[model samples]
Target chain A: MSPTTTEDSTSSNHGYAKTSLNTVNRYRGRGQYEYQHVYPIIDEAPILHVAFHGSPDQDDFAFPVILPMLGCTGNFEEDPNNDGRRSIYLHGYVSSRIMRLSRKNPASNNIAGAEGIPVCVSATLMDGIVLALTPNHHSCNYRSAVAFGYAQVVEDEPERLYAMELITNNLVPERWQHTRYPNKTELKSTGILRIDIHSASAKVRAGTTGEAREDLKDETMRTKVWAGVVPSRMVYGTPLPAPTNMFPGMPEYIEDWVEEWNEKAERYSAEAAGL
Target chain B: MSPTTTEDSTSSNHGYAKTSLNTVNRYRGRGQYEYQHVYPIIDEAPILHVAFHGSPDQDDFAFPVILPMLGCTGNFEEDPNNDGRRSIYLHGYVSSRIMRLSRKNPASNNIAGAEGIPVCVSATLMDGIVLALTPNHHSCNYRSAVAFGYAQVVEDEPERLYAMELITNNLVPERWQHTRYPNKTELKSTGILRIDIHSASAKVRAGTTGEAREDLKDETMRTKVWAGVVPSRMVYGTPLPAPTNMFPGMPEYIEDWVEEWNEKAERYSAEAAGL
Candidate 1:
């Protein structure tokens, strides 16, 4: 599958393979293990839910923490969507819990006899709510991806900068180039994590709702209940100028990006619902 | 906070209070601990990320799992938003790991009696991306809520039904009344977890983007960087009937609900960005 430069790039080629960690147990048919399919969903998502075991050595009580993080998947030299090999780059405060943990446990697989923090990152985009005649059949039309990887702190300055640039561009194309580059102080306070993905899977549920055959046969129930797909799309409204913005008006790039995303969101959502 | 019958009832009063578990450490000013403020965000969100610690007695590796679950906040008697006392009702498959774990460890406050399953439920609604002249100041205008609670399997039949009804209504108002009621078999296969919220807090960042004073003073940086809020909203598109739907077109309730939610999503998003 080729990646679509639009929102909800659900149609993409196989990139990751089925692994024990990334296998979709419940809805096997909807699962796509290829990197091409999984990376797009990861890239398109605005936030990634990072989950890790809290206090792994403690046997008294186990707590898992999941934090909403800003991240992107790509290498510095290649486009994330088109390239087969991609790593997730997550940004956090230098002294953050996740960052500190990652620093202590650096990636060692390549060097042998090394340990790294294990993390599971998940991203989801809801396309529509599938309303069925029966409540049992009600489902959501969504695109979701889960990735298992080892995360390590980025010690290299160039690699960290590259990751930061990728994350900024992920928010808005060419946003990094437009914004003031990070200074030494800013870079010192920020921490970057490079998650080397071991396995990943993408699950997509699209099209119309599915009703039970028995429910359809029941005329009373069929007439009384409405079964359909309520397509949900993320739209970008008109840009609002900042209080400190001394500029005359919103810039052309901001306007163009908003318009482009709005159109893509509507089109992709419609397509997902088979409109 | 009185719950609105209409879609996206963003207007509500304070409900929950500050506690040790639910306090916002990083940005204290943005934290809101009132039930009125927290419930609406939890209700408006499409999905809740449920995080819990994996095996407590194991000396081996610990794993934290985060699952996207369908849920709502309410009591049996009154509207959740209006009522000060509320519990989060989460719906899931009976055989799911979270459900099984929650059932094994019932919530108990007394010492040495029993260990309750501690869980953190979080919901986030992204309003817009706040582009700034400098990368350090860039942020997202969003409303997020985090609740710390002890989760236990809901065994009481009436409360279970009530929770089910609340969750169904959350999907679309009065949805439970229209769809065929669940049978004994259906109810048996499904499980509901009542998270008795001990503490909760909401963090909301709204209005336009904020640029650094230094960047604002720099004329060239100000002119080059486009700093503004690109409002993001989730919209509901035209409903599409299922192939098995023998009914004549979409129902009026479905049509009205879709239009109402679409408007609310747009309105709330714009308001969050101070557009």
Candidate 2:
């Protein structure tokens, strides 16, 4: 159900929109968010982070809702018109000490606190799995986005410990300047929201292979039972370290970002090691 | 919020039960059929399908209604007693003919369909992509599955061409007696839908470090940036055949399934001829 609506906020500037960090987030129910673009003013942009997974491991409770550009070297390719890697995204700017750690977690207590929907948060990472031969036609091949707007919370105190050290040095740029920052009760129980530049939108869909149109010598869509697609990704390798890090070398920007993550882990490990 | 509910339907029909192949077509949005853990007794199992794609080359879309077995394929060592791969899937259950070709598309005419809501599906395939080390903490170390029940719509005619020749011989086993079967206008414009397995589940997560809660000795969860996870799969090498058939050769069950996909491609061919 491709629905849409969300623009009327004129000023009151809530931030977001360096082209809304390359929009795409879809995972309905439990913090609902949607914006399936068949086209609607190319869907707006704002709101960013919402990458959850407190469990089932993905590096537990992953975070990314830190926005605000300026001197910017979260090197999203140092702004190729803020490339947004393909589409756009950049949500969460929360910093009221993480909204009092989500109001001391009773799970973000009352009136739907997470500080009531700030603004701009778009995410989408459903990249592939179209195994069809029928088991209710196993499907999946996605990439979504529709982050609306919010984040403006970094409440002073040394810019809330420099926006939590620019979100831990923009997510571990060699460990936020040699670590150990964030105190004063971890910056008074962390939260730092921010959004503006016109809230979010990053419409996408690589829909190809609708296949199924046999008869012309009927090749049964070339079946073998193990058809195609199983790509799936979200990678980054070569960090290991920390066996009690006294640092046994390795760091020229972590050996050139792990030789570019061993060349994208040797081309996605030779197609999942099945060359 | 966990919130479970099942207090009866025969106690939500526990594990491996079956039924539903058009039992008086009870119209739920024209043509009813959909069930997971097909309620015979008590609990939950709504549909789940999470498919995505937009890059890594795109074509993504997956329907998820929270943990409803992404679509099924049980038989984990032949049913590990109703934990049988801890069910939560929603795959092709024999491709309900691509939701009957998106119920005559007009952008799915006005979805709200599946009034009979009972659909179990599960799918898994992600040989790798575990790249960690903070890039907003990357992850993807998987195999994945979980499916639970309900489907009915095979409208007679010899159980709809013997359930499309048992899903084309469960996906190509001797090409359903060497091809060519569905006649009566390809079984009345082929719609076929059937699933009756009261409760079912399947599970698997797979390697390259996935145990979680080592909590990496939390110095703020390590992060020199560049952690691991970037495997990914969908291998089914050797098995070409059908260039127009006539291979008076190749059939000992297609040479034992192309010698079991070339012995899993020569034991994952050095991670598929790495890079």
By DockQ, the best candidate is 1
Instruction: Write candidate 1's Cα lDDT for A221-245 as tens digits.
Output: 7777778778887778888776666
Fraction of true contacts reproduced, model 2?
0.02
- Cα displacement (angstroms), candidate 1, residue B41, comes to 1.1
lDDT of 2 at B127: 36
For residue B29, model 2's alpha carbon misses the true position, in angstroms, by 48
Give a tens-digit lDDT track for model 2, residues A97-187.
3343332342221122223223223333443444333323333443444433322343557544554455443333454554334335434
CA shift at B110, candidate 1, in angstroms?
11
**Isolated chain A: TM-score per model?**
0.88, 0.32
lDDT of 2 by residue, B1-275 (tens): 00022121311223332222122121122221222322211111111332111111112111111211122222212332333222221223333333433223312111123222343333333334333333222333332222233343445676555555544444334555553343454456555544333333332233333223443566454543334333433333333322233334444664585466435533442242121
Q: What lDDT score goes with residue A92 in model 2?
A: 33
TM per candidate: 0.86, 0.25
Docking class of 1: acceptable
RMSD of each: 6.7, 23.4
Error of 2 at A158 (Å): 4.0
